[model samples]
Target chain A: MAAGNRRVDVEEVNGVTVAKFTDKKILDEGNIQLIGNQLFSLVDEDRRMKIVLDFSNVEYLSSAALGKLITMDKKVKSINGKLRFCSIRSDILEVFKITRLDKLFTIKENQEQALDGI
Target chain B: MRTLPSSKVMSSSDDLTEEFEVLIPSDTTAGHEVQERIIGHLQTRNYHERDVFGVRLALEEALVNAIKHGNGMDPAKQVRIYCRVDSIKIRIEIEDQGPGFQIEDVPDPTADENLERPCGRGIMLMRAFMSLIEYNATGNCVILEKGRTIEEAEANDD
Candidate 1:
């Protein structure tokens, strides 16, 4: 996407890059695509090996959004990187559990927990 | 014996069903608009927060599948949506303009081997959130339903 339309707020905590989603819905197809690109850039362009996805601002997300996360996870792994998700709402957490993505990804209750071992 | 007015009778009935139909172009933007309309109706009916959340998510997936997969994002094509939000249940049917698909052919996204795949989770999420989901024989149209317990609906049931 464009530099003006940043989809994530990226910060660094102890060498671990934290990318927090800025959108609340994460439903728009264009938005999801941009998010996917932005996330991929973290692994491919920025060469950030350790990452955490903060979902505190996300109130809703669709399967397309989930698809982006799956791809993001794969990209991180391809680089021998670590990615964790933190502060997912109960509803979205149910989605992860239902899709069994909870088992595939490292999910923690809060940013503190997610950053602890990473 | 006197009977209530037709509208009054409807209000007194066990279910207050509201029907909606809209034809949207083969674009996901249209999908978001329709989703908001349906979600707004459910919110007005005072559906439980979780029920609203699930419906919103399922509706999003179904619309994306119709516009992106079924319609192939062809602007010349259109998607037809028929919905009924009753007192206790919501039924939505979405029809697309592309060749039909076979639901049976869709691999299980949650399968052990497919866990890493990114694309095939829409159908799985729909089934997870909604009470029922079925595709027509042609697979161009899919039906989604959810049975929710809204407080006002429960009072009406009694």
Candidate 2:
């Protein structure tokens, strides 16, 4: 059941935790909440883990889902950990740009770029 | 998504008039139903891809505001949605039954001080994607329109 309800596929690469989302559209509130919890869990379990959120599969995202990412960023910052977003589609990237969150969080063009420094 | 949109009453017409009205309770299901219906109609018409994406985002935000913030998620209250979709243009209006607040009171989420704030970005996103977003005096109702022009769409592709 744990893997069944999980909206993200958590994988470790080069000592970094990469949570690749499985859903194409992250707009639904239920999936957003579950995704938030899973993202939070990565840090909650180990505060020092560097996290990379791969969004190549996400086609649609809502402001509510963005709200969750903001919260997760804060949580990671509180622990002095690194959290990055990568592989964002142009449209979803525009959402971050419009919200001015591109400045607030670390964003990269792809997972390779995200993991390069973090 | 917890709120999968409401599917109260969709007008069954043989014509391609993408106009329908839905009356939904505060349960948060009806709003999504309307969103799906409108987006599906837009896709079938071969609307611009960017327009379709933007419309879906703005519609999601507006519906959330109407159901969660406007109606306070009160099951007793009802939200009404009116939608009209045409080729390259769409108009949607959502009104909640709860007492409305002033639109001026919402803080600028993009401002320096409030940038980290998680809430209050719905209206901002709605305004950014939609060509026109006008709220009535009560702020309980919001009207959103997006008319994508050929030149503009080409410009966006650049």
TM-score winner among the candidates?
A: 2
Candidate 2, residues A1-118: lDDT per residue as tens digits? 2877899988889899899999998887878899988888888875646999999999999989988999999999988889999999998888899999899989999999999978
- B11-48, model 1: which lDDT tens digit per residue? 32334667767889998877888888888878888888
How does each model score on TM-score?
Answer: 0.89, 0.90
Which sections of candidate 1 miss by over 4 Å? Answer: A1-3, B1-16, B150-158
Model 1's alpha-carbon lDDT is 0.88
Return the DockQ of model 2.
0.70
Judge candidate 1 at residue A33 and give its lDDT: 83
The collision pairs in model 1 are none
Regions of candidate 2 where Cα sits further than 4 Å from its true position:
B1-16, B151-158
Worst 10 residues of 2 chain A by lDDT: A40-49
What is the C-alpha lDDT profile of model 2 across B1-158, one tens digit per residue? Answer: 35433474455344555677778887656777778888898889877888889899998998888888888898888888988876767889999987887878888898989998877788888898999999998778999999955665456856
